[model samples]
Target: MAVVKISERGSFRKEYIRWWKHPEKDIQLFDWLDENERERKTLFSPGYLRDRRNPLPYGLTKMECGLRAAAALFAGDPQRGQDYAANPRRFSMSVHDHIRSLRFKYRRFNSKIGAKVSNMAYVDIQGPLLQKIDQLMLVECPEWIRLHFHWRTDPYYNQYWPKDQPTAREKPVQANAPERQLRKSSPGLVNQKRALQASAVRVRDGQNKANSPVMELPTPRENSNSGTTQVRSSSTTQEIETLASEGGHASVIHGGATNLDGSITSIQRLELLIQLRKLDIEREDKKYAAELQRAQVEAANRHQSEKHEIMKQLADYVTGGKGSTGGSSTGRDE
Candidate 1:
């Protein structure tokens, strides 16, 4: 499982999902889900696990960028964001409704919905919508958003608020959640975090070393009188070059390369995220399988017990009949 550690900046980070990614929306929604799940314990069940609704294995298909943007946009709407934070399922269902309406509207007038908008303004909404969403989240929300956000449904987020903070929502988003709990309760998770921490630290350090600007060695100078200059090969420079070559980062650092440290951080986070998501999916699948198996076993036992009871009743009926007949026959013969 991916471990969440307090970063150098002290914000919770999970893969590409940063706590400060989409403030007033993404972070809040993530927390809402966590708290809701914790309180209601309404996570994946055997039935849901078997069904296709919101399949367990997330990121199997990356969400279309357009939809992702639209969702972000929808959430960034101060009113909508608060509503969604209050009720995720209801908000999602509303999206479903809007999608249906749009599908009907577009399908009636245009055959090429992707290229043309029929009666609408834009040709392809994929980019524009995303831009608007980005603008709403990255720029407008912090300025214009109303602080009186409240949920009509459940206030799971508000329960942990402090007495002094005059905010609708409470709690500095839980840095460590279930995975955190697992670390405390399960030795395996603790060991796993340690191993992953060590590995990421190594990659981070290696990238920093690889990306460290190559120190400018002194350029060979021409002797004014002799018109010749001898270049002394520095063993230190040779060793550095050798190390770079051995590390396979020699060419990577040249030409003002992109932040190798940032890239490594992304890679490390992504790798761990994939592992954690897959593990979570695997665990859910296993849980469903176990529950299903248990149900089947219970069913089989109940059926066997019923069959035994029925057989015993039939045997008793037969034995009683035989006894009665024998007694009558003996009486008649006597």
Candidate 2:
């Protein structure tokens, strides 16, 4: 930590207090406060935690202590500052200490500034800390800073500490582990899993329906009884429509017994309808061709008859004969 002169301490403390008391303070401070509140809830909640066992902590981690000290210094809490300065080691507890000790011992160490120093000198560390916090408040907040971002991973915070210094709140990275540790499942993968499960259930239900027995249908006959034919046809049509609406496939229909009505499923009925339509189209085409051929033959015969009649009239005029007889027979009348 950088040391500041005695004369500047008062101004730094005043600036710190002003920043804390400002109505429109930095958004990062609010975010940090919210994160602290959430962390406190998680730590004290009656739930299973991977790193922590006891609901109540015996000592505060370094990160926790730094947050507390910052809040105290900003709030102008003299009693909290005095308490922390007197027992620095108690708040600056190592996480490894509890991990190593089966009985969870919380051992305290001597303060670096020495206990013999005056109260004002011991609290002088606040000047530099307050200046650093003020400087940090001016910079833009990074998106990655959250409940998991610790002093060990923060380059700005770690600049003052030694390279090999261990953070009590952060666990050491394992050699085989990835750079970033994920504590929660990805939301996208969870949604995909749920969709797959739902689709599987729908498929299972479809299969069960296909395996069940179907009701028998009335058979249609080619007899001249119009009423009987109409009844059977209507019943079969209704049953086919119901099956079609249910979205039954060919495979599903085939699984049912073929009864007197040919056990024809809705899909089979549609296929038959298509075939019948094709046959009707073919019949109409053949009928049209036959009519066209008859019209063409009649036209050719009429043309030949007219040509013959005209030839006969021209030959009679050239021979000067009335009808087929010579003209001498009508001389007396002339």
| Highest lDDT model number | 1
Those runs of model 2 whose alpha carbons end farther than 4 Å from true positions after fitting are 1-262, 321-334
Q: Per-model C-alpha lDDT, please?
A: 0.34, 0.33
Q: Give the per-residue lDDT digits (tens) of candidate 1, residues 1-334.
A: 2211223456632122222222323323423433443321222111222243443333211122223333554566653455445444444433333333323332322221111122122111223332332232222122111111221111222222334643222322332242243223322324434545554465557665343221111122344443221122233224333433333222111111122343322212222333343344656768989999999999999999999999999999999999999999999999
Lowest lDDT block of 10, candidate 1: 144-153
The TM-score that candidate 2 achieves is 0.22
Model 2 weakest 10-residue run by lDDT: 102-111
